[model samples]
Target: MDETVQKSCWGVTAKAVIGLAGVILLAWLVIGSESAAMIAQR
Candidate 1:
């Protein structure tokens, strides 16, 4: 039972890490595009 609980916790932690990484990647892409537009306008 203890091992099962540990496995579940690890799964949750892994999912959280992946989700956070995806968010950061999306933000970077958005910011990059915005900056690119500004540069082009200038």
Candidate 2:
């Protein structure tokens, strides 16, 4: 029973890491497009 609990905790941590990475990528993509457009205006 203890081993099962450990395994579940590890799985939850891995999922959180993946979710954070996805949010960072999305923010970069949105900001990058706007920055490019501003530069092009000059």
Best by lDDT: 1
Q: Candidate 2, residues 12-32: lDDT per residue as tens digits?
A: 999999999999999999999
User: Candidate 1, residues 1-42: lDDT per residue as tens digits?
Assistant: 999999999999999999999999999999999999999999
Lowest summed lDDT window (length 10), candidate 1: 1-10
Each prediction's TM-score versus the true structure: 0.95, 0.88
Q: Each candidate: what lDDT?
A: 1.00, 0.98
**CA deviation > 4 Å runs, candidate 1:** none
**Each candidate: RMSD:** 0.5, 0.7
